[model samples]
Target: MAAADVIFLVISIIAVGAAALAVTRKNPIYSALFMMVTLLVVAAVFQMLSSPFLAVMQVLLYAGAIMVLFTFVIMLLSLRPEEMGETAPLPQRIFAAVVALGVFALLAFPAIEPGVPAAAASLAPPAAEAVRFPPAAGTGDGATVEFGATAYFGHTIFGRFVLPFELVSILVLAAVVAVMVLAKRDLSKRDVADDGSDRDPPPLSVSAAHAGSIASLATSTQPTSHGPGA
Candidate 1:
């Protein structure tokens, strides 16, 4: 195998192993750390693929920002050890494994085929020679505006994929709102009943009940002095 292929193989193994550990670990903090490792390894793989922008995004957006958020949320929740136990049924685990294996097969099969390079080239962006830029307006001498990968990426995202981009933003906002709603303790439900009144008073304590009975008996047994009129 070529050196690049060997390097890719090593990185892929590390990324997958770390990702698996991230999900399966019992401790949330440890899981987050493992996830960071996975993200960093994936970023390295992106760099190897000659996509510096993607590598930077993987590090900054996922490893740095998102992981920090995850760690903060995990710490804020203060999860107990018992709460972290694996609760998924055996059948669910088996099904998950099967699904994962199927996905792996689907992805790997195309990549290993001899026609993979041609397929990938067909899907890739147009070559530099094929890119046509409109003539610069000011000068009669026709000059095409030269732009880099970042400009192309921005154009593609804002121009062609704007709807999907906006939808993703809305989805993220909804997720944030949902998390806030879930985290903030709802005292309204706890302090009031569904009928919009205070909850029923707790049953009287044993001591209070016993004291009331004793007082009643004492009142009944008390001897009353005869009044002057009587």
Candidate 2:
């Protein structure tokens, strides 16, 4: 209800709107710019919340670094020709629009309909008035608590939940490798044959058709070589 809260809400709403536009925009460059705006607005909201760490991360990681990368990638790929092609089919286009509308409805329905408020009531813990446990003696020294020391990085690789983490890492590595391999073009087969240009030799099927027409074209295009100059 405060002025600051109202400002924060307005910024958040604009950030969400810009992000949606980023995904739906027809021009990739404009989409990237909108994404950058969304990220900057999110960083501002984080700053308003007093979380400087998250705010800095949002600005540096997303707005500065990731958005630049996205913009450069969109520029690198020559998509102008493809952009002029036909749009999505009517059935698929309608289905996607319906799904998007359904998601918006789900988000808006809760805000509009107010029921008995039983859901909120049920979320309260039954032991709300339970006695608290006193802190163990000598535990509150000036030393900082390291949360992940025993649970993760410093622990053995075979620790609990390690399998899930390893699986995720493997999946991400595989995806990176697959994308790199697929993006690469095979130029090893390109070589200079009797022709001047360095290009891949024609396939057997094409070469056979070319061979059949070569004699006829050569007879008409080039004079016959005779022993004496006539």
Candidate 3:
């Protein structure tokens, strides 16, 4: 096998291991970290797939930016042990495992099934027979660029999908703002609890309040105003 195939296999193994750790980790931060590793390895796989632009985006957009955002949100939430909740019930765990296995089988079957072409032409035709991309411009000049080349992807995205793209940016911005708000609210609550711990006395019980009222009534019998001055 070629060196490229060996590298690809190594990357794929790392990606799978990291992904499994990401899924099974009890700590969300660890899970997120493992997920970041998986994303980075996936980016390397994308590079091996001859998709340099996708590789760069997978690194920048997912492994870098999105992971940072997720980390911030997770830290801000500060989930407690109780909030993490008890382990899943046996039935739920079993169900989840079954579903995961089903999905794995579905994805694996197409590649491993006997008689399927190495390129999986049964599922998708050879690249040569694939539908052609709409050329960057009319056919006046015989110019061609690979789809998702840096220049081509940028032009296609900004030209055709600009509005949806902008909307997604807005959504990400809104999520960041929301996370900040939630973090501020959480911090403020913590501050109040810490600061007020001594300042706010425990509430009076009913019996204590009644006893205090009776004491006040007893002490009121002095009646200074109705004494000798009257």
RMSD of each: 21.1, 17.8, 20.8
Q: Write the per-residue lDDT of candidate 1 for residues 41-121, one digit (tens) a residue.
A: 999998887766778888998888767766655554454444444456789879979999999998998878979879888
Clashes of 1: 0
Task: Sort by TM-score, best first.
Answer: 1, 3, 2
lDDT (Cα, tens digit) per residue for candidate 2, span 123-188: 643442212222224755113212222222222234444688899878766665554445346656
Q: Which stretches of candidate 1 lie over 4 Å from their true place?
A: 114-117, 128-148, 173-230
- lDDT against the true structure, each candidate: 0.64, 0.57, 0.64
Clash totals for all candidate models? 0, 0, 0
lDDT of 3 by residue, 1-230 (tens): 99998998899999999998977666666667888999999999888877789999999988887676566555654555545445667898799899999999988886778766654655642355222434445552224445546655665567657899999878766665554554353544644466566574432232222333333322322222211222
Q: How does model 1 score by TM-score? A: 0.62
| lDDT for 178 (candidate 1) | 58
What range of 10 consecutive residues in model 3 has the weakest lDDT sum?
221-230
| Top-TM-score structure, candidate number | 1
Off by over 4 Å in 3: 114-144, 152-230
